[model samples]
Target: MTRILCIGEAMVELSAQGDLWRAGIAGDTLNTAWYLRRLLGPSHHVGYLTRVGRGDFSRRAVDFMAAEGIDTSHVTTDPTREIGLYAITLTEGERSFTYWRDTSAARGLADGPDRLQSALVGCDIAYLSGITLAILPDAGRAALLDALRGRDVVFDPNLRPRLWPDAGRMRAAITEAAGLAALVLPSFDDEAAHFGDADPKATIARYRAAGAGQVVVKNGGGPVAYGGPEGSGVVDDLPRDRPVDSTAAGDSFNAAYLAARLEGGTCADAIRAGHALSRRVIAHPGALVRAAV
Candidate 1:
């Protein structure tokens, strides 16, 4: 079986539903893992690596993964800390978040090098994101990067400026992390805002120069630019409807794109697959949509 391990934080998510609030479990890497679990069949094993607390929310997060057929064996528990929480506010299909994660247990996910190494053992692909590094301490990021060395790494520079101490540190860390990935997926808008990339090609060029084997630049509901060993080209995104919530568009796209690539599809074909799934995901209300793509 092909084992894929996604390393990052999963938190309790609250979204406004009419006059009340709806709660669920979701995060960037976890959302990708969830979509990957659904997209890939039984032969592919999807695992999660993170630290949560003993609280009810934490327990629910673990149980959610188990219920979705994702491997939760690498999920470590913290006795003193609890899971992080975020609330979503959507305005005309666009969403924004308010986070409460300063003392999140996931900040220490890479504290033990031995545990990190052990968690990665036998895994075929290790998937992480910019948020993963942002939440981690400098030493933790170093340890995690060290453990991920030489693995088939899939990275997403899911840039969040507030998460990092400064722009320079975020760029340096993202560039360093991208150098370790076999595939680097970045959103063009984020790259333009943070890295001052002129366009999607510029984003792809930057990552390729950072030693990444392949790079896919995602443009929100527009054309996708991708390049690597398999091929290089632009694939137009699937025709999309008015989105009810665009929360997990990129996350689901990454999952589907990677799933297609892992199943031997070409970069262009994979980009199409990613866009198709992402189009379906944005029509739903939450990050983890319960419908099939």
Candidate 2:
């Protein structure tokens, strides 16, 4: 089996549903792993690596991953801290979040080099995000990057400014992480706002220049720009009505694109597949939607 490991946090998610609140388990890397598990056949072994508390929420998160066929053997338990929680508020299909993760156990996920090396033992593809870096301590981030060096790493610069102490450090850390990734998937809006990328092409250029083997820039419902050694091109995203909740659109797209590419599809084919899955994800509420492509 081809082992694919996603390294990051899984939070207790709370999404506002009218008067009531809906609770579930989700996070950026976990979201991609979920969709990847659903898209890929049984031959692909998907595993999650992170630290969680011994609390009920943390136990539920691990149970949820197991229920979804994701291997949870690398999930470590910490007695001092519990899992993080975030609540989503939606306005006209746009989503914003308020997080309670200051003391999250995932902050120590990359604390040890031995654990990081063990989790990557036979990992064919290892996935991570800027949020993962932001949540980690300096030494932990360094350890993670060192362990991931020379590996087939896929990175999403899912910039969350609030998670970082300052903008300069965030940018530097993301660029450093991008250099370690074989493929860099970045959303145009986030790159534009934080990195001053003029367009999707600029976003692709920046990551490519940062030593990313390939770069794909996601532009909401707009055209996607991609470039790499294999090839480069633009693929127009399918036009659709306003979404129900835009949470995890880019995450789902990453999963679909990577899954297709792993199955030997071309870059253009992968982009189209990504778009198809992303459109379906935004058509529903929450991050882990029931999507097929």
Candidate 3:
């Protein structure tokens, strides 16, 4: 079995269901971990690394992960810090976020002993996102990077500019993280804002130079580009006529792509899997849809 260690924040998510509001747990890495475990089933061991508070919501999040068959043994608990939350408003199938995560427990994940280290060392892959980088303090970030040095890291620069302190700091952190990752999955819009790339080719070049062996740049409504051991090429063009919500498109893409690769699917096959999953996700309301797996 391939063990995957996913590190990030899992927060209470409040989304609207018609006139009523529904509460659930959601985060970038958490969402990926859920889908990855679902896709891989019992063959892959998926463990999540984060911090949660001693509250009902935190407990509920753990219960949710357990129900999904994601291992939460490595999740640290803090009594002081509370669980974070974000509200989502959907309009015409499009979603926008409003956060209340100033003192999220996940921010303090690296403060304790090397417990997380043992879990990570046992994993075949370590996956995280840019939001994971933003929430951590300098010391925590340093500790995380150090621990991840010898692992097969999968990074999705799921850039949330509002979560970052500044553009320069975000770039520096992303550059450092990209260098450590074996595979980098970056969205074109985020890359354009961070690196000022004129197009996907330029963005792929920038990330490739940073030492990523596999680079997959997803362009919204445009062709996806890849530069890897199998050689560089455009994976596929997006559907022109489909209406998309576009919230979890990239996250679902990352999951399907990684799952395909881990299942021994070719690069082109993986990209197709990514696109197929993403198209379905964006056609729905939130990050996940109620379709048959």
Q: What is the C-alpha lDDT of each candidate?
A: 0.94, 0.93, 0.84
TM-score of each: 0.98, 0.98, 0.95
Q: Per TM-score, what order, best first? A: 1, 2, 3
Give a tens-digit lDDT track for model 3, residues 7-34: 9999988877778888888898988887
Residue-pair clashes per prediction, in order, are 0, 0, 0
- 187-207: candidate 2 lDDT, tens digit per residue: 999999999988888888888
Best by lDDT: 1
lDDT of 1 by residue, 4-79 (tens): 9999999999999999999999999999999999999899999999999999999999999999998999999999
* Deviation in Å, model 2, residue 187 alpha carbon: 0.5
Show the lowest summed lDDT stretch of 10 residues, model 2.
234-243
Off by over 4 Å in 2: 291-293
- Ten contiguous residues minimizing lDDT sum, candidate 1: 234-243
lDDT, candidate 3, equals 0.84
Query: Which residue runs does candidate 1 get wrong by more than 4 Å?
Result: none
